[model samples]
Target: MTDPTLGELTVGVEGLALLRLLHADDRGAAQVARAARMAETREVLERLGREPSLRGPLGVELGLREGYARWAATYDGPLRLFSIEEPPVRRRLEAWPVGEVLDAACGTGRHAVRLAGRGHTVIGVDQSAEMLERARAKVPGGRFVEGGLTDLPLPDAAVDAALCALALVHLPDVAPAVAELARVVRPGGRILISDVHPFLVQLGWQAQFPVGDGRAFVRLHRHRVTDYAAAALAAGLVVSGVEEPALTPEAARTPTTELVPEATETAYAGLPGVVIWEFARP
Candidate 1:
């Protein structure tokens, strides 16, 4: 079969028109249009917009108005502080005798670049073409593919190790992604996944604050630690270890503290912003 056309693969002109109408800004519209050309972006936005829970006033306020855009901007600053730095996850993978590594949902190729730098053949996959473009620029030697965590295009047992960092929370279902991760890695190979702690989701801290009212303060997605484990088991993987990385007090300081005082340095340092799990495909 021929590959889908760019318009067919993406949101198409119709969705782009809606985005333009909602945003009411040419710049945002242009950006959305550009992103919609990629299959992943089209899928994500369509899924997000089509959810029943995401309709009505709350949906308009949270999703269409400025929710995703706000979160997207935070990736450069406040969110960056909470991201997984090179050393911790990198050390664990480098210690293993793996050759080919797959960085699923490899945002900006941070970990993928590090893995490649350590002489591992790494392939980075993400749904966002915009993100993959950035990843390609950052990690020139590594291969970057456009795909979702649930529907990977690679063959079965294709890699020695697979890593996913801070990407699963956005997915509506974790089981499919977990199964895909297992399917792509060889038996006894490792699958490392790190995501925002479920506790943070339960606490309703995933949503941005300082909205007109607190209506958007509630949790927007379902995230449970047990579900993650179950997904792994169903995918025929054994959980080897689970770890929570603590953030330094200094690293937690940010301007958003004014809006989320409860998320102060002292409070977050004791909580798990990042949770890492090791799964062995068996």
Candidate 2:
């Protein structure tokens, strides 16, 4: 028999609620939280020894456009991932030349606003119109466009620096996007790409957020560090630096209403949580 509210409790905050219930008694909730974290409601139910009433894929691969449209509203609202990302990204950008900058996949202009404020002429691009709209408002003087990393609507060698934070893993193959980034950035210019380290993915963790009743998981492709290096080298970009920042006790202590509490807080205690790469267009 199905848990009557299983559908509502399988994704996002709702899903966490279910786990919190189980976590009260079953230490295994942590395991299930990661194993079934962002999968389909029915599938998770089946794993939990129950029959589901609704039958379907756990979550559709929404691609970038539809996915961002759904995610834009809450992109930076309920969750607080910047705590893990901002410090390293800001550090990398600090050494970059203050010139024309491109924030590829500039979701909600989080980076754009920061770059523009620091005297860099920034153009933000993303595939989601909704996100671009938010980006436009967040950085009123900054230019925001709707496009993608693999096919940016920009001329070759157009910018002095480009920052694509946490966007590459969404692609099945990374070569074309790296090639595209290489093409757009002038020689000696820089490109910084960040992603959730592949180790967590291998352990069944995923990037997920709540939709209506359930959480929607971002369809992610695990890219080993070697894969990124290979793509960057083939694209004529020099790999200047690679930083794999592990989860910190400080960040974990930071409070948040994050959905789906996986055992990773403990399992990933001292493991890499993010991979930030710095590349030179030369």
Candidate 3:
């Protein structure tokens, strides 16, 4: 497969800007912004036509195994989404009665460690063995298993609650995983899920992180709001609440910001950065 080009990425960013500007509130200022974006896109296209290096490979794209393995060493380091996703999720998780909690796709036991500290018996399950190793060390008393979300390595109705964080976007279809999460929780139990919002995905969000001297990105699937609703209904889980956290200025910075800071900021401003869902088994 051909790696995406730097020029292509820049053009994509410009395209995103144009898309947002064109569809946003039809005010005179919006029209001005939309026209400016079109002009910027044309200039970028002209430069791409003349520059050969810009058309070359951007960076390495890795599969989940290789990507997360390389990421495990630094995965616990400062992460932007963690700040946006964790607070609301932790509040809901903490409110639940202390009991067995399944942290599905629980990379490096970020949530598991905290839940364990709060006297909850946390069981963290992740696909990456490397991540699980870190999770084991962090929460020695908590159980850590190498498992996938769709086919969890646990018995049915084994946990009182479940939390799947920033992992569902990796799956092409979220239904199976939703059903699996439901299967593992007892009736009347709750499940909380957090992920990069579909709007961000449409604007080119992915599972990206540092690897060695460079960077690697794992492709993310676009799951619309309806998709989550259907999955929950099919799994017999009731949607209690949904939260869409808007992007903060700090979290909106991107690699392309250097090339077009205004476009980058404008593209992401006021957009939802993450989506957190609360579900109850009925």
**Cα error, candidate 3, residue 266 (Å):** 0.5
Name the regions of candidate 2 deviating beyond 4 angstroms: 1-61, 78-80, 249-264
State, as a TM-score between 0 and 1, how close model 3 is to the true structure: 0.90
Residue 173 C-alpha lDDT in model 2: 86
Candidate closer to the true structure by lDDT (higher is better), 1 or 3? 3
User: Better model by TM-score, 2 or 3?
Assistant: 3
Rate residue 116 of model 1 by lDDT. Answer: 82
Query: What's the true lDDT of residue 151 in model 1?
Result: 90
Estimate TM-scores for all models.
0.66, 0.75, 0.90
Candidate 2 clashing pairs? 11-215, 12-215, 40-58
Rank the candidate models, highest lDDT first. Answer: 3, 2, 1
- Higher-lDDT candidate of 1 and 2: 2
RMSD of each: 16.4, 7.4, 2.3
CA lDDT, candidate 3, residue 136: 92
- What are the lDDT scores of the predictions, listed in order? 0.65, 0.73, 0.86
Per-residue error at 143 for model 1, in Å? Answer: 1.1
lDDT of 3 by residue, 1-282 (tens): 787777887788788777888766767888899888888888878988888866775567788878888889988885667777888988888789989999999999989988998899999999999999999999999988888999999999999999999999999999999999999999989999999899888866777777666667888899897888899999999999999988876677766677777787787867899999999998
Error of 2 at 181 (Å): 0.7
Instruction: Kindly report which residue stretches of model 3 are placed more than 4 angstroms away from their true locations once superposed.
Output: 22-39, 49-53
